[model samples]
Target: MKLAGLKSVEGAHDESAWAAAWVPETDTRPSLLLTGSLDETVRLWRPDDLELERTSTGHCLGVVWVAAHPSGVIAASSSLDSFVRVFDVDTNATIATLEAPPSEVWKLQFNPKGTTLAVAGGGSASVNLWDTSTWQLIATLQIPRPEGPKHSDKSGNKKFVLSLAWSPDGKRLACGSMDGTISIFDVARAKFLHHLEGHFMPVRSLAYSPIEPRLLFSGSDDAHIHMYDVEGKTLAGAMSGHASWVLSVDVAPDGAAVASGSSDRTVRLWDLGMRAAVQTMSSHTDQVWAVAFRPSGGSSRGGRLASVSDDKSISLYDYS
Candidate 1:
């Protein structure tokens, strides 16, 4: 597989774009792109041509993450101020505003069945699950504080959750944190299962392979991406090349490769089988914050990869 630049939007946002997600195709429209930025707005874009469709604003601080529900009709955008705003993807109408105060929100994902939403609760040291139908708090999967003196040494502070991903079947959940620990949980039971360890710096992103439910990938401030066997709790492999923190990672819809954005101002595509970066795209002049692959199944044919960067730009690429 290979990637060819399809289009690039310079100044896509007024500030750094921190997150990106694909909204699946609906009866009326093809798949679209959703992006959140430090500019405090969430923008929707048309693919291939990378055209700006609409910009939604109401966020109080920098938008950190954006998650699209499975139905393609609804999406949630969370900012640094700890508020999650769920809105209609097409009409841009407000659906619900959620907050778990005393617990800051970072990354978010909607379960495969669209029954629940999982959010990385920073500093609370837990994953907050919300009922999608009622928009109510369902459960908090708390990570147990580490044993010994470090617990009192404010180690929980170091355990601040950063990113999250759901297994393809939606039976399991995994979250990465500030202290470099990856916590896996059973979704049905809402129970903490185990932790995957290796990287020493904050794990900023995580993605589970769509084809291999047990194969999980993570990107970290250490500038390396590690693949893990979530069920076996083993570090399967590590891929490195970026010069700075690896800010985001996403597995291709085909599950043949993984894509990553980094503080190093580049986007790298890694061949999973080879366990190395096979392609690098340095189109952005500043730190690349997020990279995402369009979910397969739409009028949109072929694979498309989107990257947003601190340079206030967004780029779309054709992946084959």
Candidate 2:
């Protein structure tokens, strides 16, 4: 129900830390923290003391997003240079390097089942799905252009895809665009379903309730966090507090609370039923770019929440 500061790593990266995710536990080791920074590197960290386990290089123009597969063995990251790199978690061995040209890569994710990887395709207004086994591009779920605009119209860029989340059931995919629209797609059919509208600014991050496949939370430059019932295509509620853009949003492992990091230089944890922020951590000096709750269940639930910031630092908190 609350978070207590456990540790903070100053200068965790050479530049701004842009993304964070928890690599699930493996047979040999416990769950690990995965983070990407504007320094063009991704690093793995062991818990509690936050020891650096591995440093991964080769990305350019900064790493924009990072996602760990459910199996805890493989991870995928995309860079501002427009390439998605999939690699082994323990050895940091490159598994695949993917890019769909003329369709810039933004945030990328592995589905709950770890069978498919979805990449937000900027400018293309589509979500590119890859078959995890063969690393083959399977399909592109293109967002339909608005009714009247010509295909060549420059205004089309407004719908640039930036963030995405897969439902717990793995049957649906939801993506957020720059135009403040959240689009849902049916995975089996590879077809766009509908749009969830509420925010009018860039939706930077999204997270789904692990317990409810149809519930979604989105963060936007509009400086608000919106909860939506995607299945009903309705705005369930909105929480307001951050003074600047909300850069990232995450749902707690138990689904009773939500966490957000923002340009306001703070991380806020919200009480779900009350629909309000219960606590705000302001240890960060600059914009907080990413916030992630460690993925776990049963005995290790609500284990940890990590927020990385433009200040080049990472702060970890114990949530219970």
Candidate 3:
């Protein structure tokens, strides 16, 4: 698949757009794009043409993260203020307000089953789980502090959790941290199982392959993207070309390509087999924070990509 630039909406939000996700198609609407911005607003966009549909606002500080439910009717976002807002995608009605004291909130995801929401609990070194049915805290999967008396000597952000991903089977959850370590947890037991090692900089984003439950991809501030065998606990491969931090990554639904957004102000498409970037789009004037490939089998006439940037812009591309 190749990307053809479609439309770019300049100043789509007031500040840096930190996260983006494609909401799967529903019967009433085709498929919508959801984005969260440092301006403290969460927005919905009609894809292909890049038209604005709605904006949901209530966040006190920067809206740093956003995630959509598997059913496409609900989405959730988190801010630096430690609040997680789960709301209706079409009506903008608040469905749940989840909070954890002292622990800051970062990236969040609704499980593939659409039954639970997982929030990366910053500083608390844990991932919090909430039941979608009751909106009640169900479990806390804490990452054990690294073994060493000097562990506390490190900076506070070292163990600070930043992003998360749920395996397609819904049995495993992986969470990334500022220390560059990814914690793998067993959901059934709610236990920290092991860690994945590779990136030495903050691990900002990660995605589990739609086709392979064992394959996972990660983007890091180390200016590299890594492919991991999540169950094998080994690095499958590494891809590098970005001049600055790689902020986000998502694999194509077709399973042949991967897309990444970087602080270098570009979006890159990587051919998985070659393990290299084959295409770069530099339409954003500032750091591009999030990039997402639309889920396949949608009403969309063609392959689609949605990206948001620190330049306060949103760009859509036709992937063919």
TM-score of each: 0.97, 0.96, 0.96
70 Cα displacement, candidate 1 (Å): 0.9
What are the runs in model 1 whose C-alpha is more than 4 Å off?
146-155
Instruction: State residue 310's C-alpha deviation in candidate 3, in Å.
Output: 0.5
Q: What lDDT tens digits, residue by residue, belong to model 2 across residues 195-291? A: 8888889999999999787799999999999999999999999999999999999999889999999999999999999999999999999999999
Maximum-TM-score candidate = 1
Per-residue lDDT over 51-109 for candidate 3, one digit per residue giving the tens place of the 0 to 100 score: 88999987898898899998999999998777999999999999999987655788899
Candidate 1 yields a Cα-based lDDT of: 0.91
RMSD of each: 1.5, 2.1, 1.6
Q: Which residue pairs clash in candidate 1?
A: none
How much is the lDDT of residue 83 in candidate 1? 94
